[model samples]
Target: MSFDPAQALRLAHDTLDIEAAAVLGLKRRLGDDFARAVALVLGITGRVVVMGMGKSGHVGRKIAATLASTGTPAFFVHPAEASHGDLGMIQPRDAVLAVSNSGEVDELTVLLPLVKRLGVPLLAMTGHPQSTLARHADVVLDSGVEKEACPLNLAPTASTTAQLALGDALAVALLDARGFRAEDFARSHPGGALGRRLLTRVSDIMRSGDAVPRVLPGADFSHLMREMTRKGLGASAIADADGRVLGIFTDGDLRRLVETGRDLRALTAREVMHAAPRTIAADALAAEAAEVMEKHRITVLLATGADGRLTGALNSNDLMRAKVI
Candidate 1:
């Protein structure tokens, strides 16, 4: 059969509207039960063991991940697998979040008795409060949807969306209650770009010791250029004998000097240097270094210690190589 583009677009719009309405419907129903669910999970001493079957199981897995990543300890378990032995993973200190739109999946209902016997707090996320899962649950979260986004009104589209939204709400509520910060999130995601931005310090990627371009304030232009070339940082710190930074000179300054047709041989580091150059603490995050560089329109930053002594130096290239920019 030939397809009509207008009909297809209308169908897509209808589906989105239905799903969006279903999620919006959840807002009115959220009240004491949602708060109780959050309290139960927060009060638990162990992880949140989430279980479901079929599409609900997929949503359960995502909910578990969101919870774990956002500071709450949680993991997903298959209802069938739980009966086989995975049930051992659920301890009395843990809370069980069971998802079922019907609240009557035989695979899940069958485990309800055992979950209760284990003395674990059971939280049910279901559409049917009268169903077996909700009846046995210690706290019931109404994940009911007015309808599904499917054309046949049978698939788990709107309901799943509601479930996912509810899950996100729970995770964020727990995150706020626990005072979870970005640094804590970064620690859990160290291998990702966000983690590097938050956890990587200037000291971790800065060129230190001999690699840091440095010259005495009285050093000649040739000496400063040599130091910049040797360090390959495009900039050099002009410091005193005690290693305190006096100023900074960059390749940009060199270009300006050349453009003016100045006598380069007679110029000293102190004669043409940016006094009180942009500096960052060695312990500052690389993300902050990137910010300082962008804000000042400078390519290099001198890292200093608490004692106001030059500790290291980093350029835009270093930030890029470290994946902090």
Candidate 2:
């Protein structure tokens, strides 16, 4: 058998086209029912419990995460597990989002009566509106597709794509409705890079105390060089006796000084420093610090307290190390 790259590429494009069309179809079908489902989930005082089996379960897990991260508290519970002992996880105040393309999965349908008995709101995402799950649902979201991206139409491809897209749509709508901000999302995702960018403050990652490169205004060039080398921040803050930042002397300043062939030994810190350099507030977001650094075309910034005292220092490398850049 010969491997044909062109044929493989054509098949891949066809598969993508099928999935894309399925997602587009969902947008046309979205209407009052979609709005009702969003409302049902929003009105619930408890978590959104997502349940499914097999591939649907995989999609359910992602949908649960997206909902949870976007301000709707949610989690995925396998339908098979729910029948054994996990059913107890469901509360009357919670809303259940059941995913089953056919909406006829016995594991899920068997629990519908109990779900209804508990007076829990049931939202169904399925291909068949007349299926058992949808019949019992308080709100039904149509996730049906004309066909699967699979060549044989057996694999859950286009159907799963539609389901995932619809789930995202629901989450985004609820997120907007609840005014879920990036900070709120960051709070939920504190361990990720997005969290570091949104939630981390300058004081959290900046070097403080004796580690911050500093020199007295009257300090000699030798003293400045030692401070820059010891701190390894490529810059030194020129501060007064009260720890008030007066100016910044960076490596760039040093390069310019050498360009003039000036006697390095005769210069003082105040004589070469750039006065009133860009400073960021200690409590400001690390993301804001990155923006300030980028705007001024500088690599380092001196973090200042409310009274304008040099509290800490950070550079592009520090921001990168903290995953804020």
Against the true structure, whose TM-score is highest?
1
* Candidate 2: tens digits of C-alpha lDDT, residues 49-105: 999999999999999999999999999999999999999999999999999999999
C-alpha lDDT values of all predictions = 0.94, 0.96
Off by over 4 Å in 2: 1-6
Residue 220 displacement in candidate 2 (angstroms):
2.8
Q: What is the lDDT of candidate 1?
A: 0.94
Candidate 1, residue 236: how far the Cα is off, in Å = 0.7
